[model samples]
Target: MYGIVQGVGFRPFVYNAAKKYGITGWVNNSGGAVTIDLTGDICNVKKFVIQVVKNPPFPAVVNKVRCVSLQYLHYDDFNIKRSSKESDTVKFIPPDMGTCENCLKDIMDKRGKRYRYAFANCTKCGPRYSVIKELPYDRRRTTMNSFEMCSSCKDEYTTPRDRRFHAETNCCQKCGPSLVIINNKGEIQKCEDVIDETIELIKNGKIVAVKGIGGFHLVCSGRNKVVIGELKNRKKRPSKPLAVMMKDINTVREFCEVNEKEEEILKSSKRPIVILRKKENIDLPENIAQGQKKLGIMLPYTPIHYLLLEQLDVLIMTSGNISGCPIEYKNSSALKNLKNVADYFLMHDREIYVPIDDSVVKVFNGEECIIRRGRGYAPSAEHMEVQDNIVALGAQEKSSISISKNSYVYTSQYLGNLQDFNCYRNYQYVIKHLTGILDVNPKIWVYDMHPLYVSSAYKKEGIKIRVQHHHAHMVSCMAEHNISEKVIGVIYDGTGFGLDGNIWGGEFFIGTRADFNRVGHFEYVDIQGGDAAIREPWRCAVSYLYFCGYDGKFIKNIDKNILDAAIQALNSSLNCYKSSSLGRFFDCIAVLIGLKNFITYDAEAAIALENIIDENVKETYKYKIRNENNVFLIEIKDILQGVLNDINCKLNEGTISAKFHNTISKLTCDLVLKLSKIYSISKVVLSGGVFENEHLLKAVYYELKNNGLEVFFNSKTPINDGGISFGQIAVAEAVTKKQSRE
Candidate 1:
């Protein structure tokens, strides 16, 4: 059996099953798979195999199981054997799981050995990918190897019937890792109880860096605006929303609305931060989300988190890092990097071999969409039909790496953008670690087509293939849906290098996994000052107005000198690049409606626009679709004029935003219907960061489906750049196969 069989109590479950079925067999971990040898009656063996395959232990994902008839040596009884050092085949290393109910009960039991233990874990729940250093996932190959189990723990580990049997991370307070509270000056603070002291510090409005299963979290009281502002100033994070760790589901329900699907994702074993809509007139500070309408909320997923949150209702739990840096995982690094940002440190002795961020998710149209794939939902592997060993270095932003081995593509967790030096180094480290753990030697290297991307420029000794960015976006959704035939693809985002050497974001294509033809796209507009147009929305606004035969005199709250410089750049074509990005289009509208002048984060303007939309508005702005040389161009000149007219009439921002969104949705449906009619295709795939907006996604999804066509979006992988690496792998395989066929 392969796929997530290691370190998940699969062997113990198998051993127990064999004894129950009156069979003699041995089970052991080999590489990443569980191997079993059985000698018994044919019917009994078949029944045992069926039971094991059908009913795996909690959190165990059995992807494939194979059985072969062989001459079995006579064994007296079933037993668990030692692991083998076979490294030929590939198997999955499970992602780190949230604390299970059984383990939580053990921690709460006063008479138990692990009562009130901060590091309490069982086979069903604990760190897996974070602490693992090698294959065959044994204690000796993990960070837990340093701790020596006490006699009590050793007895439980040796007992076959015990839940902790062969649990590699099993230990008590006496033998496992312990926590300590320290001042920012690196001196250990003498305290009676560390958990109590940490709780007291947080309640007293002190910022504490709490080490977690994957990395460190900078935690504070979320309800206190003054403390949150102080944290923002200290961490140099100005406007980005900070995630809150609520005590329980009831606390989450107190502040935000939760539906059935959202609640299921929140209380799941893989606890991720769910973006929820805040209730009207809630007591949360405006600075928490900084003008956004949603809040990122999560429940305590670890024993230490449960202990710390026991005395507090809510705490601001953000990544322990400065702005534009990867999360700090090592104790010494945390001390050195975060000493100035944190007031106190909740230190632990357990090592984190890999640092993973918290996963972010949201529910749209009753489906859970992953925004960021990390701690509880990362190191995700999927089976694919491919011939060669492949490694796909993903795009620059939302960086991740993927490796293919044994016909399975394993994608790494979300690594931050590679623009920062520290993030770049961490990206390299993750690549080496993932490839080493899976033992994959890359015969093919795949990357994006953008020459300026750090991932595209990476040096490796293999056959290199550069894939178009938006095509990868389209195929990513297609591959997730197992679609191999041709379909209409709607790909939109902030930036992608076009085949004509321009930036492409708003795009439509008719394509298969191997190839695609550009069918329609938004018309190109000049991005003044190059990359600065992305940061300053007013610049994009001026560019759009200039192209629409309007002057910048009507715009307000922008520096006159900078505005003139932007116009000059546009006029002379200096540092101006033509972009067809719908994201920039949203930014332009955001500035025109006086939503924001500048942005501090990615998609800030677009998010603000989405937040103010009135779902009841049925009106849409005028748009023109022109067929220019067999390719449809979605012209926004009329739409720009409509937005200007609304601004002149002093219309409400909500109405304007809603009208613009509706126009896009209607135009999308119209364009897809036209293409479907022309090409005789019935399936439409939508993929990109723009689809992260729930309103647009729902509108486009249902509109296409209502028109007698099949609609698909990414569910298994991210719809953003985070899923680009997996898509690159898909494209590489298809291209290679096509080449061989030719």
Candidate 2:
């Protein structure tokens, strides 16, 4: 049995099933798979096999089960044997799972051995990928090997009837990892009850750095604006939204509107943070989400979190790291780096072998869309139809790595942008760690085409394949949908290197996974000061106005000299590159309609535009698709002029935002329809960061579906740069197959 069969009570389940079916058998974990040997009546053995495969444990994902017949040797009874490490073909690694109800009950039971234990866990839940150091996941191979189990725990492990039987992370307070409270000065705080002390500190508006299953989190009261503001100031994160951990589903419902799907995701074993629309006039601190209409909320996924939230309704549980750094998981590093940001440290001695961040998700069109894949959702393995040892290093931002073994592709959790030295180092570490654990020796290395991408600069000895960024995005969706036929892909994002050596984001491609033709894109506008235009929306606004023959003198809160210099640079084509980024277009509109003149985070302007849309408005602006040299260019001058006219007319910001969003949706439908008709393809794939906007995605999805076209989107993987590595893997496999055939 393969596919998440390790460390998930699969052996124990098999033993129990064998006994129930009156079969004598032994089950053990070996080479990342479960091996079962049984001897009994043929009918009984068949029933046991069916039960094991069809009705596995709660969290065991049985992807493949191979059965073979051999000369049977009678055994006294069913037995759980020790694991073996004799093979290199590893199939899957289960992701870190949230705490199960049974474990929670044990922690809450006053008479239980693990009462109030912060590290309460069993076979059903608790750390897997984060604490794992190698395959054949046994206690000795994980970080828990450092802590010895007491006699009571050993008894439970030896007993087959106990749920904790053979649980790798099972232990009581007497032998398990213990928590310690330390002040910011690195002095130990002596308290009768550490949980009570931590709760008091949080209630007093003090930030606490709490160690969790994967990493440390900077936690505080979500209702306190003063503390939230202080946290933002200390962390140097002004406008970026912070995620809040609510007490339970009821608490989440009080602050945000939750549909059935969102609630199910929140309560799932993979408890990811779900982005939900905020309830009107809620009492949550505005600093939690800045001015955005949606709030990122998650339920407690760990025993420590549940204990921490016992006296609080909601807590701001943001990543514990300095600006531009990966999440801090080490005890010494968290204390040293976050001393100024946190008032106290609620830490534990449990060593986390691999650092993983909480996954972020949102529901779109009644399906889950992963924004950042991590903790509960990764080290994810997907079954593909290819056999090759390949490695794909994703794009610089939202960096992730994928390795292929046999016919399975295993993707690492989300590693942050590679621009920061710490994040880049972590990225390298994850690649080494994942490849080492999976025992994969790569024959092909795939990377983005952008020359300056940190991932592209990674040196390795293998056959290299360079993939275009937007093409990777489009193919990622294609790979998820398992579509090989020709389709029209509307890939839009902030930035990507184009075939002509220019910045491309708004793109229209028609092709399959192996190859694609860039048939259309938004008209190019000079991006004055290059990256500066990305940081300051006013520059893009000025450039758009200049290109559209409109004066930007009315734009306020910007230096006139800087504006004149930018316009001069645009005219001289100095320090300016032509870009067709729809993200930049949103930024330009945001400035024109008085939303923001500058941004503090990636896609801030676009997010704000989406947040303020008036859903009642149904009007759209006019756009033209002009053919130049057999390539279609989406002209935005008319759209810009309409936005400017709306501003002159003093239209409400919400109405203008809605109209602008509607215009983009209309133009997208029009373009996709035109391309689909030309190519005679009904399958349309949408993949990019720009589609992360729920409003725009809903508009385009319903429009295309209503028009009788098959629309596909990335569901299993993120649609952002995080999914690029998977796409690279898919494209590499396709290219390899095509080349071999030729």
Candidate 3:
């Protein structure tokens, strides 16, 4: 069968297969196939065909390979022929794959020709999509075009028996990408010798920004607290943990424990930074994780990283970009943009055409933790039974695009919340590339119910479907579980634009994974401008305390300056927004206990509270609930009042946090029990971003099961807003399918 597959070394692989089996043919890449003119025995030809089809080459995806009718060659041998450009319209482009074990050994092996070469890679390893500027995945079509193979390397490439033969990324120090180093002053420290100098600088406690596969990473000596601190100061990334990269699985175990599942994810082609818990007594910089208990650690995924870290032993390789900005890919861009952040710039010549940020994850319950899906995890098409192609632009925050083409869902790499032009621009770039890769012509567009979301605008060209925020939250868990049956969805999050023009967070639903009907939600309060209370937690604190009959005494009991600020904050109607938000309620609880009236980041107060609580501890008091209109409502006002009286007491923060966590758990269980008895249903699915708190997750899980109810959560993707888009798409698909049926 003639097709578009020539010039990709398909012929050489066929020739090699012919040698493996006793066959005679003249194979060539004429029209994208092993065009064979053979006069061979049927059985040998059959074996040749099978081998050719099964193992064409390292770089081949082989979308369609079919044998043709009888064509006889009066030749005694199988030979390779030059390629022609006449192929079909459809071209199967392969995404980037990681280094193969053979290539890794060859790089590290002393006897190998490509010894200790940072750029040593082949078709099975190294950059693919990121380095490719055009299709047909050749040296000319890639960043490697600048680096012509030498005579020795060329022989290996042309040898049919050699694995490196025709490998696209084959390179060595003499003819491949070069490295250079510059100090903070923009002066080249070592123009000709970078790898060794960069390693020495890192070992000397200097932070160097190095260009990587998808972007730049600010590298520093992880073992040096002072250097890490300096890197943190320059990066301006406070509190958030800096990711630490180790050598290998063994090194990872030396720093942290890795279970079978954790090891599996670590070794996967998409080598994401898996946030593993620190093994006891493993000393690391305090700033690495800040106040958190677990350290975000990742193993080396690339040969360059392997070589660099192998020399330095341990280095703190944080993302090579400004905080909240896209990762830097180009050396010039990193040099220019990272001038203010990095102490040194480690430059490289290979071009980065596609930006892929490091994937981040955690492991629990013996399964993979997908905190941020990118690199190896991305473009991993989630096969669902969808009817048509649709584009679902996730929310502006923690952005991801879900593309559905006849049941396969392909989500783009993690695009951060569209707060800046950089984020928005990257969002556009990722979307364009993603649409190109999937070859999807979407007719229907999906978005979060919020009309003003950037993602909503992206899909303006299609039949737009607005998905409810909490409903989508539930649907995410449903999607993760691949649940086709109906179940109760216990959904709670920070905030979502409610159907009634109010802000919603805490919600409960009874529906299938596809569709959910809002059964009960937290009591609607006037969220004045939606964002007013989020920035100022004191407003939420004051509102909750005031509703519970406190004349803001908790503030007065504190410093006069604090009390005055609280008074002014309460008086300013412009700053106040009434809400029954569970997250804000947690913030209010933190405030009521005189813990914090202000926060520097989103979920700061809540996260701090979780940090304080002992998972082994339990809430001494139980929560009370009120049933309204066949829905159970937990009277949080009572909890607010009780903590108000104990404002000045030496209150146990753990107890308060536990009480808060347990109150929600008890309330949820009570709701499920009462609702199920009323409706004769016995299953509940717990979802939402709030469940990321391990303490609360376990509490809710056990309490619900103790009450004879089935519970499900995001064991894979986060239970946070990061998972919102998946849920939105599921809901949109259901709506679309139901509409079609109607």
Candidate that would win on lDDT: 1
User: What tens-digit string does per-residue lDDT give for candidate 2 at 326-422?
Assistant: 9999999999999999999999999999999999999987999899999989988888886668999999888899888878888889998899999
The lowest-lDDT stretch of 10 consecutive residues in candidate 1 is 85-94
The Cα local distance difference test for each model comes to: 0.91, 0.90, 0.70
| Candidate 1 residue spans exceeding 4 A from truth | none
Tens digits of lDDT, candidate 1, 571-659: 99889999999999999999999987898888889999999998789999999999999999999899999999998998999999999
Q: Candidate 3: lDDT of 507?
A: 82
Candidate rank order under lDDT? 1, 2, 3
* Per-residue lDDT of candidate 3, residues 406-440 (tens digit): 45566667788787678889888877776654456
Q: Give the higher-TM-score candidate: 2 or 3.
A: 2
